[model samples]
Target: MKPLSTIVQAITGCLLIISCNHTPRARTVQVQSSANESVKDYPSHPKTAEELRQELAETEAADPAGMLLISGTMQENKILIQKPDLFHHSKYATDGYMISGIIRNKASIAPFKDAIVRVTFYTETRTELDHKDYPVYKYVLAQQVTPFELKVYPPESTKDFNMEVVSATAIRN
Candidate 1:
């Protein structure tokens, strides 16, 4: 029989792999469903565009980040992480590391400019260590990609990290 500790480690590793493998499409579907529910629960309809704007403003005031994204016209972006490399930079800080990756615009034709890309570092136990957001270049053109490099100076106690394109302004051509 396998040792208890070894079995536990294997199970933990499997769970981590499963959690990290969520596709962006699945996440978008989830967000759309949740947004649908929230919109269904909104009390009234606005007669004018200005009133619609006011309603959105009030909703955003209630849930600053989520409501704006849900009510906005922007579509979900597929920011693919390509060739991500993380390396330890210092011996003193347990989470001292540098990460470099290429973020590709996989699923959009609507050009986005100056989007905020965020990385959240987590410990082995899945505890949040640190998070930082950086702006992409002036524009991430349609069907193209951008390379980025960032260092986590004081990563606290990170063992893993997740990168995301959190927010971006979509521009019409």
Candidate 2:
């Protein structure tokens, strides 16, 4: 048998040679689904400001009235008619009902113009009798309120009335 010191040295030299010959490579792991298929990860690209503006312009040009309609519908909830008062007045020898209220725009971004208020007339039993659309040709800024008074000739059986904003043109500047 070899001497103990020499045998230890020989073993150490062998281990150093083996370690120097072996190099580590990066390993890539791929996830697999239950169907034995590899799952791919896709990167998402977001729209830029210019692209969004172009798209909006195209949409507006395609359907101007439709765009207004959509915008009005989306903003209907944001428009509020507050402090409404219903009364009758003998003006111009006509018995007409007058509705006065404040139109409040709760939107924080867009100002509205040419808002239409729909006054729904109802009977004493809470049944709807008729509805009239009153055009308010006024500009109402965002987070602002405007006062409006409209004269309507509702049916004789109109005992109750409710007012709400039906449509408006959204001015995005």
Candidate 3:
């Protein structure tokens, strides 16, 4: 008996003569990207000063709280409040550890004046993702300058938790 390779070669030779014009196609695979929490890759969307102000106005009406939700597009660097200096350790079980950060609004947009910020955290639960088992933290505008919201998670003993910020509508009207 002939080898399997020889048989396959004969079959290919037949096809090659039949379709002499058509070239052999290449085989490849493309896999989709998996979701990773820590890997935060934000796309760049350039916005003019005027456009930023307009978006700030629209977002103002949309949410009563002036929370600058980090999004893929639209908002500029000013809209985001990232505390790189602060550490976020998810894998570790941090009990009685106080994790805090500030929720602030962009100053470039004047319409968002006095945008009061609100903060909340969710605990890692068995049945749900962000369970409100943790304490509900709140903040109201008390002064001229923006300050960080500092408080302990779970109020007593913090397990794995996530942070959230809600900025009240800056519009005084």
Candidate 4:
């Protein structure tokens, strides 16, 4: 008979395998059936040329940092770890859910390599979840440019949890 800790380890490993699966399998997912049907009934209204330009200007003024372009599949893959690589994870109880992904800058730029990409996943309310509440929290570290996969972690429930990612600006100090 296997020990309790060993059985837990095996189960966690299985969860990791399952969560890392990116293949489009022939499975049925029950999408929300009550989506607002009126969305289709609404009359078509196209934005005029000037109106669209003004909207774009407004958006740019609001968000100066260009949005990160992440395709759906790429987004999923970006959450996986390498099939095999060195991984180190530890919980840091801070004001909120904070994550630091160290990446060596490959560009010719000098001081960029000394900088790191810091991502903090704070709750919508800006509250940080405790380490114990989240049984499975994966920390994925990959190259920002050509990230094939992210750090894979075991599957765990994260219902109603929302997270945002923001890369910190390089601190010259």
- Top lDDT: which candidate number? 2
Model 2, 107: alpha-carbon shift in Å?
0.6
Task: Provide the overall lDDT of each model, using Cα atoms, as 2-decimal numbers.
Answer: 0.56, 0.65, 0.43, 0.34
Candidate 1, position 38, lDDT? 48
Give all TM-scores, in the order shown.
0.42, 0.49, 0.30, 0.18
Q: Is candidate 2 or candidate 3 better by lDDT?
A: 2
Off by over 4 Å in 3: 1-59, 64-97, 106-145, 153-158
List model 3 lDDT by residue over 28-122, tens digit each: 89966677645665758788887776886565556634344311111111222343445853333333333334444443333343333232333
In model 2, which range of ten residues has the least summed lDDT? Answer: 70-79
What's the candidate order when arranged by decreasing TM-score? 2, 1, 3, 4
For candidate 4, give the lDDT of residue 103: 32
For model 4, give the RMSD to the true fold.
29.3
Prediction RMSDs, each to the true structure = 27.1, 13.0, 20.1, 29.3
lDDT of 1 by residue, 1-55 (tens): 5699899999999999998996676443433455446443565763787666555
Flag clash pairs in model 2: none
How many clashes in candidate 4? 6
Q: Give one digit per residue, the lDDT tens place, for model 2 in 16-111.
A: 999999989989999656976666866487888877776665544343223222111111112233444476433233446556667776554456
